[model samples]
Target: MPDPERDIASRYREHTGRKRTYILTGFVLLVVTAVLSIAVGSVDIPPQDVVRTLAGYSVSTNWDNIIWNVRLPQVLTAIVAGAGLAVTGMVMQSILRNPLGSPFTLGISNAAAFGAAFSVIILGAGSTSSRVGDAVTINNPYTTTIMAFLFAMLVTAVILAFSRFRGTSPEVMILVGVAMGSLFTAGTMFLQYFADDVQLAAMVFWTFGDTARASWEELGLISAVVAASVIYFTFNRWKYNAIDAGDETAKGLGVNVEKVRLVGMMFASIVTAIIVAFLGVIGFVGLICPHMARRIVGDDHRFLISGSIITGSLLLLSADTAARIMMQPYQLPVAVLTSFLGAPTFIYLILKGRRI
Candidate 1:
């Protein structure tokens, strides 16, 4: 007869090895997608040219400009924003014990939308410029981004404050988040109702999440925050894994369940707030990527976290690339494509009955 202990050890090793392979495959695909995104834009620079341009050798000034000034920044933004949103979503789902938990689940996206509309309509930061043929333009993006960040953080603050008084149970947090989302949606509608044609157009435009809007400066800030968040999450991976077993079980395992949940939620919210403020609410990435990673890697936070990051970056980068080339002169919003991709995949996941 086979030794039972050896059999179990072999099975464990095999499982771990498969997860590692999946993660490595995902990261390789993510890099390929990033390269394709940089190369397959309106002008369609060759992959060789892209590599040369990136490596400080100029193929031509025009290719160099397109690669460096336009496609590179957009691709970088998608990778960073995708990673941040996906990781945050995974953390929220684990900590809150809710399959539906995401950055937007806590009302951050809706609140940021309200703040952006306020700046566009009330503050007159966004206006239609006749010089650009009445195209909507944000005259002061700094004000809009700042306001959006503040309002998103406000929603987080409310949730945190409530958690202080009431216990940090998953049910209570989900209920509060849904209520807050509804409140902010109503406020955004109220602002839209009073706006004129120009302001109304601007507000609507701001809601369409676009990675093209980010510059190197904005990308730097996003990268810094996301890098820091990834570090924190990595350090607390074991605690999250323990908590996933169940609250009481986690406490028995010496995990400070409440503190871990609270701190994890706060960091996730900050990542969400910063991304929404700059990118204007790239939906579905935060929600779907975690589930996709979970389906592949199982509940172990070790593989799941890195899996989510790679999956998120790959999905968003592919969507952004499609958005750019779908319309020659006019690009669609990245969020629109993400919703298209996410909805069907989400329905498929439901049909398959994959658990969180």
Candidate 2:
């Protein structure tokens, strides 16, 4: 007879150990990295002040304002946006079974950008953004963000419908997104050409992502979305792991393969849309972070997914901090720095994979 007591004890131990490794590790890393982000800024406000300010204690208004208004929001935007992008990439990879699957490759980000551009450019919600450095600041930032998110959902729905006919083949779905992305890019170029100098300038700045403008209100919305995604994805990790094996295998295992893919696709699109809308087009982190996490924790989404979230948040926060400090009195686009780091690392991974 199987030793029931021994089996139960072993299972319990394994469960606790996994929780510690995945959940505890993620929590610790997030806290440490968050502090590092808080400390590294233009005007140094010690960690104590940051905590004190958060605790409803009084501090210098200048220090208070800079910490609360500027660095805090930027740090949060980077973390939330990074985590969202990374998890979305992982989900796309899960369902598509393609290593290159990401918001960029799948055209979700581009689609969201196109929607935002239409609102500002064609419809004139704020100002026509067609050229470089031409930013059409609108009365409501969230209004433009909502438009991007909704449009991205529309695009995802179309992709889902196509995928049903396409038999969920990674190649077919991703190829369609690629063709769609090209079309969107062409449209953006046409708009830029027709735009005058001012609008062109505004368009340029937007294409490159910037985290400097993140505010408390924006942070609240972004955090809520990302936090919910993290939780939802966490519970759904096993389903993702099954899908990774193969859709047929997942279905044989009693998984609702299509439902899972549809839901994952929906959530992933929501994530990409929200991040792209507010943060602009930050590129490559989504692709890089998931690969990095998978390399560290293997293909199991339980650990790999949570690890991706924490690592992405850390990487972006550090990168954004560097962007701020690298050029005194000037802020560079977060996308530029992320691309620099993410692209090289991604290339390294590809080479490493081939060698192995």
Candidate 3:
């Protein structure tokens, strides 16, 4: 007969080794993609010069300015935003126990878009007008961002309020999200109807989810929020694991299922709102990255969350890099690329009968 002790030890070793390998591979890919994203913009900088510039070595003034002022900030924004969205998605799916649950599914993005539209159309924020011979002038650049954040929080508040009474039922939450999403989308359309050409254009552009719009200051804020959210999620990893196994089971294990779900939803919503407010509605990163990470790291939250972060960063950076080069002088929306990439993977998973 086989030795039971040796068999257990061997399996444990294999499991731990695989998890480490996944994490290491993800980290390497993230670094490589970040470097490529910084170097391969409209104004190409060589890989070596990109490294030298980052290390505080003197390069040409123009190259240094381009790397420091333009590309690096954009790349970092993509990285952080991607990681945030992915983690938030994982939390949402786990807490809600729904395969399709995501920040978008919760209607946060739609609400943010409505808020942005309201700012542009009603508040006359981010509006530009040109006289027959005059140049266009933009007014109230921060208005859309502030409005988006506020509106997103409002939606989250509403959801949480309903959940408080409904007892965190996944079906209830999903239905509430769908209803809220419809309401917000209708509101956005109403605003668009009243918008002028310039205001309409501004609203449309804001929804494209471009990382190029993020300033260093904005990136700094995003970094802080994402870091805090990640830390919170990490601390609550065991709670999430329990929550994922079904609420009754979790309750039997002495987990406060309702409270954990409510708190997780709030954190996920806030992180999602921050990203959407800054970058507009970048979808599917949250939906797809979590599933990808789950496949790689399995259901354990400790490895799964880290894997999601790294995979998300790698996916978004690669997509953004492709967006930059695909059109040469003109760039496409990173959201478009992500949707195109994610949709197929989603369908394949469904067809394969994989448990998402």
Ten residues in sequence with the least summed lDDT for candidate 1: 128-137
Question: Per-residue CA lDDT of candidate 2, range 209-302, in tens?
Answer: 8777667887788788888878888888999899888888999999987777777777877778877888889998888888888776678787
Question: What is the Å distance of residue 241 in model 2 from its true position?
Answer: 1.2
lDDT tens readout by residue for model 3, 1-356? 54577778888888878898989988988997798789897788888888999999969999988999989998999999999999999988898898788888888999999999988888887655654311233376588889999999999999988988887888878899899999999999998898888888888878888777789999999989889989999998998898888788899999988888888888888998988998888989999898988888898998988988998898898998898789876777798889889889888877874677
Residue pairs with colliding backbones in model 1 are: none
> What global local distance difference test value does model 3 have?
0.86
- The residue pairs that clash in candidate 3, if any, are none
By lDDT, the better pick of 1 and 2 is 1
> In lDDT terms, which candidate is top?
1
User: What TM-score number comes out for model 3?
Assistant: 0.94
* CA lDDT, every model vs. true structure: 0.90, 0.77, 0.86
Reference-based lDDT, residue 181, model 3: 92
Give the runs in model 2 whose Cα sits over 4 Å from its true position: 1-19, 125-143, 353-356
Best of the two (2, 3) by TM-score: 3
Off by over 4 Å in 3: 1-5, 128-138
**lDDT preference between candidates 2 and 3, better one:** 3
Two-way TM-score contest, 1 vs 2, winner: 1
